[model samples]
Target: MTGKRGRPSVSEALARDERVVDVVIALLTGDGIEALTFDRVAAEAHVAKRTLYGVFGDRTGLVRAAIRRQHAYLGDAGDGSSDLRSASRAILLHLLGDEAVGIHRAIIAAAALHPSLAQEFYDEGPGRAQGFLASHLRAEAAVSPELLFAALLGEPHRRRLLGLAGPPTPEEVDAQVDAVLRTFGLLR
Candidate 1:
């Protein structure tokens, strides 16, 4: 006799989707974009190929979803508190983190071939983070959130992207955040 069949519960579907995204991110980090095939993701995520196809439609969809998940993860790294300095430091640290750096490099290298991925990365990743910071900025602050984010990242982030240096220590992050706030006169 055949057993009853139905779609997975919402929580189950979410968990499976999360697993797929996690596997894609791991593949992207470990072997770059070249290694992120649906077969590999299915195997690593322990989900079926059909499930991936059904959920994401195609490789591009899967990649976009993974990038979006990465952005959400990075953006959520900070505590939920409204402290500007804390939020700024969290964004800086995430930008400089090894995984984020790798993802950034992969997107840049692949952008010529895949403009959609590049746009998604910018919109969902850095753009989202900047919006988060801008929300916390004082109403009367002279500097725009984009400018403030640039100053907060500045040379250190560039060095990380160029592979010339590692992420800053917590102390260095604090110093930079303080300096950025001071420079913008956004200090409390």
Candidate 2:
């Protein structure tokens, strides 16, 4: 939608911003961080370069936005999770998905050169996951949310990160979650 004089309405601007971030994520997952640039993203997103700068400030900001968006999508699965078991399973499944793995690979590749981006990735991804689990663990008394988060991902996530494995099926994810919950004595 456009307002007076052909200016984009607020909703249109936000939609365009989302489109730009989607382009950024695609670029990142396809070619890593090096492929992310104002020029290329502007062209791929079909938006003005100035708009990218205006909204994201610079390359780091753009990267941050993309990472956050990906994390949010992954975290959404946990929104309806009420108990520890459901939340743990949802978080594990979401984190093990292809997009999550690709984002993880991209961040790891950029970590040494861009420490801030690495930190951003941790905060948005694992940190948020840990916090999500923590909320559900409030009644577990002895269970450590951080440890549970680690255990949930464990070797499966390692295999995915190394490209030695594909996304696990629901049954596999359920088994992994049950095993981890059993280890924590939290399975019901």
Task: Choose the strongest candidate by lDDT.
Answer: 2
After aligning candidate 1 to the native by TM-score, how far in Å is the CA of 171 from where it should be?
1.5
lDDT of 2 by residue, 73-176 (tens): 34544465477777877777778888778878998999999898888888877887788887777574577778888989999999999999999999999999
- Which candidate number maximizes TM-score? 2
In model 1, the clashing pairs are none
- When summed lDDT is taken over every stretch of 10 residues in candidate 2, the lowest stretch is 72-81
Off by over 4 Å in 1: 1-14, 73-80
Per-prediction CA RMSD (Å): 3.4, 2.9
lDDT of 1 at 172: 89
Stretch of 10 with least lDDT, candidate 1: 70-79
